[model samples]
Target chain A: MKLRIYALAYLLFLYAPIILLPLFAFNDATIIAFPLAGFTTEWFSELTQNKALHEAVKNSLFIALMTAIFSTLLGICAARAGAMANFPGKRGIIGFVMLPLVLPEIIVAVSLLVILRQVLGVNLSNWTIIAAHVLICTPFCIAILNGAFQNLDPSMEEAALDLGESRWSAFRLVTLPLVMPGIISSMLIAFTISLDEFIIAFFLTGTNPTMPVYIWGLLRFPASLPVVMALGTLLVALSIILLTLAEILRRRGIKRAGGTDKGGFL
Target chain B: MGLLSAPFTYAILLLAVPLLAIVLFSFWTQDFMDVNTTFTMDNYREIAEKPIYFSLLQRSLYVSICVTIVTVVLAFPVAYFVSFKVHPSRKSLWLFLITIPFWTSYLIRVFLWKVILGYNGVINSGLINLGIIEEPLTFILYNVNAVIITLAHAFAPFAILPIFVALEKIDRSLLEASQDLGESKLMTFLRVTLPLSMPGLVAAVLIVFIPTIGDYVTPELMGGAGGKLIANMIQVQFLQLNNAPLGAAIAIVAMLSVTAISLLFVFLNRRWLRGRS
Candidate 1:
């Protein structure tokens, strides 16, 4: 009984800041103090009309889309190879590829800036941000897709191969259909991560900033607090929706692959 | 093996190359636009001689330790509740709810803590209005405490999930057997449950500790003047100071510190496990 109450409080503590976003976004006050200011939708309306925010959002969307596609493609190769092949040093190779998952974003951002901007003398642009995003997002994609591949019956692909089919044809015909839901789920997840990523984009982005960078700029001016709150509310809502969809698809992929429900990635 | 070539090549080019570049760059000196390729330890020496850099590193380690302890210790009970006490059918729903806040904009979440803890922020104003205090509380924001609180909150899910996974894997029959043998519930938990969950606890510690030291946002946002950390210093060296070599040196130092500490933690845990078993 005590544990139940503690869990309730713990959830409350975890959620209080997120709850404040929508509360203050609609509150009819510039200051975020809690005096029960009258509700207003002005902040949301303001966000719609902001041209710069729109531009940032567009840039972020493009970057996120590219990141999702490329990372999932890379992840498919890695995951497929991992599940099917017994290559030498495979464990070490996979660990090395997944190193970015735990490395500090600042360190990654700094090192990439040094190598790309300084050594290569390449102009900082959205492409650099996309590259960094793909590097980070690929590990997560591989993690998700590995589950999809693990749940599949390896014999199904071998059977297709034995029936006068090329390896590529067998994979395309037998394996791709099974992991399609997983592919979509991983893509959605990668898209969400790339969309919300701030540190790498902040470092590598050239002239145009991503949405999170734009929000960080807005945070500097006190007058834009409510608008920032409004933006936060929208982003939180979007992320929750995307992740819920991704998790659902992930579970569906597990079921489709004839795997038991083990409560896959959330 | 053939299929892994493309992604492996990309990973090597982007990730591995940059890491090696950092190690190489740390030894070189930069003067204005020109980076002398000649290797030197001047940057490392500068870091050692400078009081600001050393103090910031110390504070970062301290803050990270505090945040890890706060997050993991607080999260353990909540994880235990969901794993052992909650209905099996509802576990996914509970885990999902816990993870929703984690996926939201991390930048915004840190910023919101600044709002909630500021001088005229929610807590202060609410307290003032309720006559709980004559003046708004000023200590909650813009200090190390605020940084710890914001970080502990942000990384709560990371700590909880690993511990929850560990707890979920424990055999419930062991607990029943302990109780059947006349052990108290607390004793059963201490003897049978805690030892089994140490792996998850260690993972939680590393997950929280490693990233907490690298955090530049929370300190920059909520850490007022005195509360700045090593990442902020690393940022200054790269962006404001235009000393990429020195920045690379600091990054290397911070990374090594984290790696050493984490290794030591794991080593100690191994010993503890062996000793117990």
Candidate 2:
């Protein structure tokens, strides 16, 4: 009984701040204090007029979309290779590729900043941010896709090849369609990760900033607190929806491949 | 064959190159015009001589250790409840709900703690309204405690998921056997459950500890003057102070220390487990 209550309390603690975001957003109070201030949609309406916020949002969407595509493409290659090939040092190589998943993002941001600015002499841009996002997102993508690829029967692909299909055509016709759901799942997850990422974007942003970077900038001004809260409410809602969709798709893909659910990172 | 190996090559070039650049920069000196390629040990010497860097590094370690311990302890019971008490049908739903907060913006989550804990923040106002205290508690915000609470909250899901996975993987027959042998519930849990879940628990510790130690955002926003950490100093060195070599040196040192500490923790944990059996 005590344990059940503790679990409920833990869930409440986890969700309370997120719930508070929408509450205070709609509460019509500029100051982030208590007392019922009546409900209003003014903050949400105000979000439309902030041109800089719009640009930041647009930039973030573009970056996230591109990151999803690039990372998923790279992930498909790596996961397919991992499932099919038995090259020398394969385990070590894959482990090395996945290292960025656990390496501190601040360290990655700092190191990338130094390399891009000082050594490589490349200007920081959306492409730089995309590169870094791909570095982190690819491991997640690989993990998801590895599950998809491993579940595939090698005999199916072999049958396709024996039926006079070329190797590339066999992969395109047989393997690709089988993993389509997993591909979509990986893209959605990678997109969500890139959208929510802050530190790397914060460090690598050039003239234009991503949404989180813009939000960080807004934090310095005391008056923009409610506006930021309003934005946070929307972002939280969007993230929950997208992440739920991704999780569902991932589970469906696993089920389609006839793999036991070992639980996901979700 | 060459095409099959391209991804590995790309990973090497992208990840390894930047890391090597940082290490090389740590040894080289920088002047007004450019970063001089000439290598020197001055960066490491400066770090050794400076007490502030060392102290802040120590503080970061201490804070991260606290966050790890607190998060793991709190997470265990919740994971236990979900793994043991909850219906198998509802387990995924519970996990999905737990991860909802994780998907939200990390910056926003950290910032919300500032609102909740700030001097006139949620807790203080609520307490004042309830007549619990005449003055708002000042100690709850702008200190190490605030950083720990916020970080632990942010990382709760991280701690919970691994431990839950560990708990879920425990063989049920072993538990039944222990209980059938006339062991108390607590005793069975201590001997059977706790030891079996060590892998997940260690994973939770490493996941929370390593990142929290190097976290700059939480310390920057929630941690006021007194609560600043080593990452903050590293940020200043690179961004504000124009001291790349020093920052690189600090980053390398911090990474090495984290590695050493984590290995030591694993070794100690193994010894404890061995002694127990």
Best by TM-score: 1
* lDDT tens per residue, model 2, A80-127: 888876878778888888877778887888888999989889998999
Q: Which candidate is the best by lDDT?
A: 1
lDDT of 2 at A110: 86
Tens-place lDDT digits, model 2, residues B1-277: 3443666666776789989989999999878657887989999998899899899989999998999999999999999999999888788788888888987888888898988898878889899888998899999888999999999998899899889999999999999999999999999999999999999999999988988866888998998999999989888888888888779989999989988999999999999999987
- Measured against the true two-chain complex, the DockQ scores of the candidates, in the order shown, are 0.69, 0.61
> What RMSD, rounded to one decimal, does every model reach?
1.6, 1.8
TM-score for each model: 0.97, 0.96
Error of 1 at A212 (Å): 0.9
- Per-residue CA lDDT of model 1 for B66-176, tens digit only, reads 999999999999989989988887887788789878878989899989878988788888888889999988888999999999999988998998899899889899999
lDDT of 1 at B79: 89
**Residue range with the least summed lDDT across 10 consecutive positions in model 1 chain B:** B1-10
**Clashing residue pairs in candidate 2, if any?**
none
